[model samples]
Target: MHLIDLRTLQQFVRVAESESISRAAQALHISASPLSRTILNLEARIGFALFDRVGRSLRLNNAGRELLVNARALLRDNERLMLDLQRRAGGTGGTVVLGHMPGALYNGIIPDTARRVQAAHPSIRFQFESALESEQLEELRRGRFDLAVQTQDVSDPALASRVFASERYVLLMPRDHPLATTAEISLNALVEAEWVVTPERAGPSLRSAFTAACRRQGFEPRVACVAGDIVSALALVAHGFGLCVAQESLVRFSGEQILVRALPLLEMQTVYRIVWRVDGLTPAATRFLEALAAPSKAATPRGQRKR
Candidate 1:
């Protein structure tokens, strides 16, 4: 038997799974011609046809089905070897990519946590991107991230996550609004109040909680405007457009003219979780998540006073 190269084997697997060389090449970040050549070479080594050419598509042959099983095992081994090599070269000094929801960024934890990671691991670099909860989870499954912080309930048993903190939704109104004077307000009283809300997908769990609270009070929120995220929603409150229910993370950006009061009747809470892949994490990624769990310093804007 001819020697089988791992790279060629991996390309074959991608092509089989995607069922198209174009898609496989795109996923592997290579052009179609080189990928096609690699697959041909792999077939030559195996001495059997892996795929049958149809009019415009390629269908996996019986041999392809058998090879795919071994291909996956080999690819997994390669990944393990790469992870081991990365850790051995540097214990906790590399790039750690993190995904988080926009609300988490406003909660002050994102920056505070990142700052902590920098302090503890000076040589480690960090990148954080705001994404929807589902998108973050999907990317984590694809092995595209080192960590993710989101404000939704992750029910997937295959993934590992820990709740770093819980944030309650506070009623935000214009400073001069009649409802702003109360120390706390009941959700029942805001039945007719025009409200601004975040995107539904960004906080599905929280949205369900808020809707249920409204239903219990015999009313649904009169959504006057739907903002892109918490920041935009709060900005609407600042401009006297309407009231909004924002997480504690948004407390940092609410203007001075906006009043934040606790909602006594509603049981809306957002949990910020630090999630990573179920497989073993690199030393650098592990250290970064540890810092995220325990913020090393208080997070405050450069020119703002603590609330």
Candidate 2:
């Protein structure tokens, strides 16, 4: 048998983990043909097919299953060696792949946290990725990312998530809108206005909360357009497309054109959490999380909340 080729071995490992050649190629940032060729070459050298095809899907063969177990161990050792070398050369200078919901990134928390982490640990690199919450969880499960910041709990009960901050939700509208002058508009009043919302998958809990709140108000919301991110939501509001409900942290990005206020009838809030695979955290990921865990000294004063 030909000796193991680490490059081909690595590709095979990714394919096995993702169970889809196309997905593996996308995650590795390579074309499908090249990834397929690598796998074919490795299988040919070993004189046995590594995967069994079933319709449009593939499953590892017995030999492939055995190789995968060893392959993962080898990959881990390889990573350890690289990390050690990097540490010796300088310090913790490696990319920490982070996935966050689109809404969080536009609201400045992700950028601010990333800046602070970089300032504290210059050598630690970051790859900030914006995605839907479901996509984030899937990537985290597939070993594509180091960490994820999300506003809702994923359906998976085993994944570990830590609460980073608790922020209250508020309604946003145009400055001259009738509801803008009220200290707190009732949810029933919101029912008469068109609503802009985040994707359901990204903010399922928030969606549920909003829907339930509307039920309590005796009418369902008239959804206008579902903006994919917070910035888009704010943009829609600025254009008078629809009113939006968002977290108080969103106020950081609000411009003079938009107005924010509390909803007297809707007191629901969202707890933003940092999630990651318990077993897949890298050294940089650990350090960044430690920084996030650090107590915030810049919090708003107790008696005053952001308007």
Candidate 3:
């Protein structure tokens, strides 16, 4: 009965995620033979086989699946402990990695917050990565990101989030389109109109919610293109590929070719949140979070912006 080291647990998690010793070794910059031996040793130490051999591939068995969850939590705790120790030893500078939805960048909230934090604490560095909602959540849990700005609230007990801004959904279309000049538009009125939408993925997606809203109004949206993010969707709309539903703040990036109309009938709002793990913030990350929560004199209220 011996305790497994963090390095061994990390190797186990990587093997479980990639499902192949060779692939995990490639990723870990090691050779397959040694990685395989490491996994065998870990299983021997735990007194259980963690994976099921199926042909050339391996799948996590029930015990492996349970261990995977605990392993991730333990790794996250270890990371936080190291960061805390560094801070106590008078480490004043560190990078705060932020994973965010594209809207946060397009609307300038994340950039503004970063500037404010850096101005006061010049030693702190910031890295911003834009990803889908589901990707951001996964990365956060894996300890890859210190913070995230998402469109929807997260319910995971491991993370904490608060709404910092809110914006309504608006219809984006080419300025020369038929509906561009219309004083009012309804979801039913766009029954024949084609749309540009985000691709459907796990977690709460704008596409799924928008599609359901369209169905409640007696029509399914005719998707003309599937864009990865709102910026791409706005570009598609600007080129007359199709109309799109996006956050109102995103209209700032639409240029002159695109017109934005209020989607009052749809009654959708994108709530921007500052999300972080409960005990996972490094010293720099904690400072950035505090700066984000403080009211800024140079910033405009996102929810009160005129449509």
Candidate 4:
């Protein structure tokens, strides 16, 4: 059977509402003859009569009532879909799904930049997913995320990235720990200290880099606890579990419970970057990227020593 057009469906609904073909046509500003033919064509396409003829008017049958309900719902959904598409095309609205490391939230760039974007385009929205660097990169490659914020250098030709900010790694310790009094500690000095670190499976970049840095200093880091992310690692440090090396931006989360110290000796810095598929950014995503590139008064945490 041929599909019934939307115009026919509309006319059918108006006729069903007025219970008179002549009255519905008058309301629609069309002649009664064409309206009657449109309704007849709809019934023929669907292989059923929609109305029962009374002496001078029509009453909707059960099939007509069901069609009216479903048609109205479909039309509403279609209208919403069109509006959303138009907004996106005009760069005024849409949702951007972001995959990021926990540090992104602490760094101030993601939250800071997002706030600015929303201030300009209130209709644009964001969805955030925090995971390990490796997991975030994998999800980004699979197209589950529109953009990602991470530290690892992405060399894949299919992806493009930009460095938005950089932060050095800092040592976090219990406020009363012996080394906490030191202004800057050397990596060699902490050879005997127990460390809280992220395991390779959770995120290999930080772990492998820290391990290499430790090896260069002539000793391997003695792991006391393994946490899934930097936030958890810092929590372990606060409870005297062990020392943790993390991005300086995370000092804000340490509150007054822990002491943060600079590791000038280690010279480790993680560069934060925004990455996306070379070809897949939506207009909304592009607008967000532009906001990130624009300079703003909100500053990302940098070289923070103690909190």
Highest TM-score scorer: 4
Full-model lDDT for every candidate: 0.75, 0.77, 0.82, 0.83
What residue runs in model 1 are displaced by over 4 Å at the alpha carbon?
Answer: 1-89, 183-188, 202-207, 293-307
Q: List the residue pairs that clash in candidate 3.
A: none
How well does candidate 4 score on lDDT at residue 24?
Answer: 98
RMSD of each: 14.1, 15.8, 16.3, 2.9
RMSD of 1: 14.1
- Relative to the unseen true structure, what is the C-alpha lDDT of residue 271 in candidate 1, on a scale of 0 to 100? 71
**Model 3 alpha-carbon drift over 4 Å, by segment:** 1-92, 297-307
Pairs of residues at least 3 apart in sequence or in different chains that clash in candidate 2: none
lDDT of 1 at 262: 72
lDDT of 2 by residue, 206-247 (tens): 566787777876888899988866678889898887788877
lDDT winner, 3 or 4 = 4
lDDT order, best first, reads 4, 3, 2, 1
Give the candidates in order of TM-score, highest first.
4, 3, 1, 2
lDDT of model number 2:
0.77
What's the TM for model 3? 0.66
Clashing pairs in 4: none
Worst lDDT 10-window in candidate 4: 298-307
Q: How would you encode candidate 1's per-residue C-alpha lDDT over 186-211 as one tens digit per residue?
A: 55568868887765753454456667
